[model samples]
Target chain A: MKARVFIRLKSEVLDPQGQAIESALKNLNENNIKNIRQGKLIEMDIEAKNVEEAKKSIENITVKLLANTVIEDYKIEIE
Target chain B: MKARVFIRLKSEVLDPQGQAIESALKNLNENNIKNIRQGKLIEMDIEAKNVEEAKKSIENITVKLLANTVIEDYKIEIE
Candidate 1:
C-alpha cells in the first residue's frame, strides 16, 4: 500500500519558517499573499495486511514519528 | 483566494533527507516502509483578480522562488 501523510503545525503554534517564507515571497513581489503556512508531505509505501491495518499503522507512524503531536497535526491518505 | 502548493523532488533527483528519514523509520521499527519521499506543502491566501491570473502568478512564483525547478516540481491548487 501507498500512504501520503500531510503534517501541519497547529493553528496556535508559531511558525517562524512560514513567516520567513512570507517575507521572502513579498520580496519576490508576491505582495498579495497572506496567511502563508508551510507544512510537510511524506509519501511512503508500506506492506500491510489490509486497508484497515494500513490506516491504523499509518496513524501510529504519523503520531509517533512523523509529527510532533503537541504542535503538529497529521492526516493520512492510503492507496 | 486560497492556494496550496505542493513541492516535491523530481523522481530522478537524489534526496538525502528522505534517505535519512527512511533509515530513521527503519530504526524505529517501521520495517515495512519504502520509498519515503519527503516534500513540502505551502498554503497561502492571495488577493487575485481572477483564477486565471492567480494561476499564472502562482506558476511564476513557484518556478522562480518556491521550487528549484532544476530538481523539483510543484503543483498548485487554488480555491
Candidate 2:
C-alpha cells in the first residue's frame, strides 16, 4: 500500500517561515494576507498483508518520529 | 482569496530527508518501504479585487520564490 504522511504545525504554534513568506507577499503588495502556515507531506510505499496493519505501522511511525507531537499534528492517507 | 502552494521535488531529484525517514523506518523493521518523497504545503490567505488578480499574484510569487522551478513542481489551490 501507499501512504501519505501529513505533518503540520499546531494552530497555536508560530511559524517563522510562514511569516517570512507573508512579509514577502506584503512587499509585493498582496493584500489582506494572514495566517500563513507551512507543512510537510511525505509519500511512501509500504507492504502489509492487510490495511489495518499498514495503518498501524503508519500511525506508529507518525507518533514516534514523523511529527513533533508537542507542536505538530499529523494525518495519514492510504492509497 | 486563499491559496495553497503545494511544492514537491521533481521526480528525478533525490530527496535526502525522505531517504533518511525511509532508513529510519527500515531500522524499525517496517517492510517494503520505497521511494519516500517529502514535500511542502503552504497555506495562505490573500485579498484581491478578483480571482484572476489573486491567481496572477500567487503565480508570480510562486515562480519568483515559493518554489525552485528547476527541481520542484507547485500547484496552487484558490479558495
- Candidate number with greatest DockQ: 1
Model 1, range A1-61, lDDT digits (tens) per residue? 9999999999999989889888888788789888888999898898999989988888987
Q: Which candidate should be chosen as best, given TM-score against the real structure?
A: 1
lDDT of 2 by residue, A1-79 (tens): 8888888899899999999988887787765767789999888887888888888888998898689999999988997
What is every candidate's alpha-carbon RMSD to the true fold? 1.3, 1.8
Q: State the lDDT of candidate 1 residue by residue for B1-79, as single tens digits.
A: 9999999999899888779888888777888889989999988888899999888888888887789999998999999
lDDT of each residue in B1-79, candidate 2, tens digit only: 7788889999999999998988898788775767899999888887788888888888888898789999999988898
Badly placed stretches (over 4 Å) of model 1 are none
CA displacement after TM-score superposition, residue A24 of candidate 1 (Å): 1.7
True-contact fraction in model 1 equals 0.85
Regions of candidate 2 where Cα sits further than 4 Å from its true position: B49-53
